[model samples]
Target: MNARLPERQASRALLIGSSRFSHEGLHDLPATVNNVQALADALTDPAMGGLDPSGCRVLTDPATPKQVGDAIDAVVNEALDTLVLYYAGHGVLSRHGELFLAVEITDPDPYRVHYSGVPMTWLRSALAESPADNRILILDCCFSGHAVEAMSGTASAVGGKLDIRGTYTLASAPAHETAVAPVGARFTAFTGELVKTLREGIPGCGPLLTLGDIYPALTRALVASALPRPQRLNTDLGDHVAMTRNPAYRPPSRSASKPRVVSQPHRSPTGPHRRASDEQDPKVAAEFHSAMLDVYRKAKKEAGYNAAYFLQMVQEVGGLEAARRLIRAGSVSSGFTALWEKGRLDLSVEAVVLQDRFAGLFTDEELDIARDRLAEYGYSSAQTS
Candidate 1:
């Protein structure tokens, strides 16, 4: 039998959904409860996140201010290594720009929000104070973007802003936009698409699904539904930090007996001589890089904004055989670059940190060329240093 890989860090989730409100003007949302249950189920699926059912809490109809605070404290005080907080309901914004998660008895009155709603600041404080190594916040409600604005930038204590370290925040809409819950649907637009992405999993993204892989798909799904576009605030973790395992991972077939080898025809003496080193021809590498840029531009324009689907689109743009040739030739920089742009930044300072990894896959000449091109986009050695 093959040895299994060790499990990921222990993680817990708290899902809250509010449907009813004290004010009659705010109609109850039928999809909110469904969102909580579906997400909870996915979190507990062995083929998915594999979280313990007892560690995942689902609070429907939204708990009061005190209950929400207590719940956060209890979860964060545990010995878990990671904590995820998800809220699906009506997100309210005060005149001064503070955000709140509306509870079952929350009053719609703009002036009385303090008395009825749970302030996002409270949750932020809890997360900032938590001992967990990683924290994730997913908000699927109107004006969820305010949460991102509330938590942006490096760790600091002033203004009650949460320390941005070790945290990833996914907001369903812009600060002023309304996150829609389609009537009769099983989940909210933001979460319904999220669930689908989680189930299908992303190709070329390995056995685990990180928030980095999920963001592009979720944004495209919401945009296609004509719902508010999702926003994300991410921290630079050196490598991909996974939130869950792909539901579709399967072990490779094993063989007990010795494997057989097949022999190929020997090259004729007159045939072209092949180099022993893995380094690729400079001209061929340059051509491959140029072709990749063209394909990336076309893919960006025609493949829509969903990066998850672009993997197949890329295969279609360049035939499978050509891709295989590039890989065999050790010209993997092009493909690595294409994959990185699928979800990560195009030309931000963050790209500088990833330059070494992407360039390492290239030959010396190709690496020089890549550095030159990246420098044109402000990714310079000085910046990274």
Candidate 2:
């Protein structure tokens, strides 16, 4: 272990999330990807965690052990003052009571566990031996508690009595429990609340919040959700370290600050009257809204994404009336296709305008689905700038 210096420490983070498993029995964890993204965003948000973007390394759906090992080595070698390593995926406890982090290609067979996943033993050793004074591990997976147990099991096995003197480990669930993602939510339960705490700030945490300060609230949320309580294990950290700088977050003012005086434009009474068809009934409009949302939901499910860009594009063309007609005609697909052919949906423009709005929301498969949708409407992601 390296000696702590008198000066301020540089910081680096490595975030890993594995969603797809090649093994037939192991189901994919779609929420892991979202958790990784949410954490990344929180860490990089200037008013929040404020870590330099270049110092953060992210790996998603990595199948090979080399990919994971190399990433871990790269970040650990940096020897920064602060190092945060986060993993969200399937975690298995072996027959020997060892913990293993599953990768995309990890076979579900119990006998093949050694070859399929990374051992928590190796990770613990790496972190313990790292020069960084502040080593933080955040695990969001089933059996995450096993990793912590393994870390403390045999200190000598992980580099001479396991020098975890300044390390902090946070696990989403207990050893025998499973970490759950809330229904219809984009992020896993643990991370969703964590991000909210980071972004919105916690009362009495002051202007700056530390991982230690946020732990209690996080524990409360998990318990309220009926989940296994999250655990935070620390080894001889003398003082709490600030994880993020919370801006002066406040509820928006309920009443408008100032009312603007507007001059009404004069209209010609003899001009053409508004079309009765354009003035859709409130009930019909509500149904149209619901139907439009259904179409978007279907598209998202098929595409495996939750980007708002799809809704924006649909709204750009025909508004609610087009959606009403499609639902009424019992032909959402073909109607959408017809709208595509009419050049009402500009794929390229929408992609550019909503790119940031939808960042980290679309997976490769979802983008492909969106591409297919565009093709049916005579457009392509490649063709769009």
| Candidate whose TM-score is highest | 1
Name the runs in model 1 displaced over 4 angstroms.
1-9, 153-158, 236-239, 248-385
For each predicted model, how many residue pairs clash, with residues at least 3 apart or on different chains?
0, 0
- Whole-model alpha-carbon lDDT for candidate 1: 0.62
Candidate 2 vs. true structure, TM-score: 0.60
Residue 145 C-alpha lDDT in model 1 = 88
The local distance difference test score of model 2 is 0.62
Q: Which candidate is the best by lDDT?
A: 2
- The TM-score of candidate 1 is 0.66
Give the per-residue lDDT of model 1 (tens digit) for 1-385: 1111113346677898888776785778889999999888877787665567777888888547777777777777762477788999999867667788998778766678878888877777777887766778899999888888777732232275456587778899998899888888888888988888877875433466666557755665677667788887765441135656765544333531122221322643212221212224455444444544455565457543333232453455532223333332211132333344453334221232224323322333333333444453334544432
Model 2 Cα shift for residue 4 (angstroms): 15
lDDT of each: 0.62, 0.62
Give all TM-scores, in the order shown. Answer: 0.66, 0.60
Residue 283 in model 2: shift from native, Å? Answer: 77
